[model samples]
Target: MFKINNLSAGIGGKTILKEISLDIKPGQVHAIMGPNGSGKSTMAGVISGNDNYEVTAGELLFDGKDIKDLDPEERACMGVFLAFQYPVSIAGVNNMVFLQASINSIRKYKGLPPLDAFDLIELIKSKMKLINMNPDLLQRGLNDGFSGGEKKRNEILQMLCLEPKLVILDETDSGLDIDAMKAVADGVNAIRDDQRSFIVVTHYQRLLDYIKPDVVHILKDGEIVMSGDYKLALKLEKEGYGWLS
Candidate 1:
């Protein structure tokens, strides 16, 4: 469902990704493991059409259409979701309003009618249960005054509601306690379907223990150095990224 072909992206004038190519089929889970500054997060940013990075070369195809020049909102509308490494706090926007608007935008893009208030409420409630999110948080401002774990849970809640075709999570497990981590994993797994896929970017293998990846790619410097099965994550956990390099 997602294909990156010879993709190289950078910020300012410095290139971070070097001829990076990978394919994630529908229903497959791929984990990207890399040390800091290895361009793992950059890949996520580029794929999601983050304007901060300029693509020096290559093309990205989402569902067979080139998306290299698509904006971030456009990508999200095309069933692409990025669970950010650091969840941002929108001080004034209420979480419920933000999510409902997001859903409406996506539906409009797909030529579908917007959800009614009752339908949206029911949808949010169902997704909240799936993600183990407190319904009370929905009434609050987006991420304002939320705890670290709460921010992460909120990200997962957004993911569940969006139901993206390809979900790219950048450090979703960072700053999450064991219980919170499990909740995120469960939410992700619940969304797994024949038309959905995941690309989880993480430093530690602990999160992979809960969300088992079909393939693991070890990224280094600015490229993927090695690709292996789930066992590779275990090896890296024991030996560290230094050995892989």
Candidate 2:
């Protein structure tokens, strides 16, 4: 469902991802593990159409079409959802209002009618329940004054509601306690099926214990240094990246 061929990218004048190639098939969950500054987050951002980085080489394709030129909103409309590592808190932006507009925009793009107020509320409630999120969250500004766990669960709630085909989770497990992590993982696992794909990016393998990636990749510097089945994550957990040196 997604392919990155010989992809190289950088922000400003510095290169971060170097000739990184990955193919995420439908229903496959791929986990990328690496140390700090290893370009994992950059890979997710580039795939999500973040304009801060320029693609220095190769192509990014989604569903067999080139998406290197598309904007972030266009990519989201195309079923690409990136749950950010650090969800920003935006004051004065009603959470429900933002989500309603977002879902409606995607629906309109697909030649569907905007969900009416009644239907929208129903959808929100169901998604909130799936992630065990508090409905009271909607009463506040988007992520404003929310705890780390609340923000992370809110991200999962958005992904569940959108039903995205390709989900890129950029360090979704960061700062999450065991219970919060389990809640997020359960929400992700609930939506897993044969037609959806996921890219799980993280620094540790503990998160993989819950999500169970089909493939595990170890990234070093700007390139994929090693990749294997789930055992690879276990190996990294024990050996760490020092073995590579």
Candidate 3:
């Protein structure tokens, strides 16, 4: 569903990712593992169309169309969802309000009728249950005063609600306890279907223990140094990146 061909991107005229290429097929989960400053998150950012970075060479294609020129919102509307590494707090925006607006915006982009209040409420309730989220969270400001686990679960809830074709989760396991990680992983696994694809970027193999990626890629210095199945993650856990270096 998504393909990156020799994509080199950077911010402020400094290259961060150099000739990175990847192919994510439908219903497959791909895990990207790397040490800090290895361009893991930079790959995610560039794919989601973060304007801070500029692509100096190569292409990013989604569903057979080149998306280099598309804005972030446009990429989102086209079924690309990037769950942030650090979810920012919106102090005044109600969670349900934000979700409704986001969903409706995507719907409108696809020429579909907007969901009414009743339908939206039902949808939110159903998706919230998937992640075991508290209903009270919907009434609170987005990510405001939420615990770390709560914030991560909230991100999973948004992913479930949005139903993006390609889900890019950047460190969704960071700061999460084992139970919280399992819950978040369960939510991700629940949403997996024949038409959906996922790119999971994480540092540790613990997250892979729960999510079980079909493909594991070791990214270092802005490029993928190695790619394999789930066993690669386990190897990294035991041997570390030094073995590959």
Candidate 4:
């Protein structure tokens, strides 16, 4: 569903990712593991069309189309979803309103009719059940005064509601307790099907225990140094990244 061919990206004239290539087919879960400053998040941002990073060389293709020049919103409208490492707080925006506007925007882009208030409410309630989210939280401002676990669960809720084809979760497991982590993983697994793909970027192997990626990639210095199956993650857990260096 997505392919990156020799993609080299940088910010402010300094290169961060060097010739990174990856292909994610439908229903595949790919996990990117790396130490700090290895450019894991940079890869996610570049794929999602963050303007801060400029693609100096190579291409990013989504659904057989080159998305290198597409804006972030355009990429999102085209079914690319990035669950932020740090979800921002919108103090005045009600969660339900924010989500409905987002869903409507995507639907409009696809030439679909907007969901009315009643339909949107029903949709939100059904998606909320998937993630075990509190219905009351939807009435509050987006991520405002939410606990760490709550914020992460909220991200999962958004993912479930949007139902994007490609999901890029950048450190969604960070700061989550075991229960919260399982809940988020369950929400992701629940939505997995033959038509959806996932790119899970995380530092630890714990999350993989639940999500169970089809491929595990070790990214270092902004490049993929090794790619293997699930056992690779188990090795990384026992032996630190030093041996790979």
- What is the full ranking by lDDT, best candidate first? 2, 4, 3, 1
Instruction: Look at candidate 1 and tell me the lDDT of residue 79.
Output: 88
- Cα lDDT tens digits, model 4, 60-163, are 98999999999898999999999999999999999999999999999999999999999999988998887788899999999999999899999999888888
Tens-place lDDT per residue, model 2, 80-113, is 9999999999999999998999899999888899
Which has the better lDDT: candidate 2, or candidate 3? Answer: 2
Error of 3 at 235 (Å): 0.4
Residue-level lDDT tens digits of model 3 in 54-149 = 999998889999999899999999999998999999999999999999999999999999999999999989988877788999999999999999
Model 1 misplacement above 4 A? none
lDDT of each: 0.92, 0.94, 0.92, 0.94
How many residue pairs clash in each candidate at the backbone level? 0, 0, 0, 0
Cα displacement (angstroms), candidate 2, residue 48, comes to 0.3
TM-scores vs. true structure, each candidate: 0.98, 0.99, 0.98, 0.98
Flag regions of model 3 displaced more than 4 Å: none
Superposition error at 68 for model 3 (Å): 1.4
Error at 226, model 1, angstroms? 0.3
Pairing residues by index, what is the TM-score of model 1? 0.98
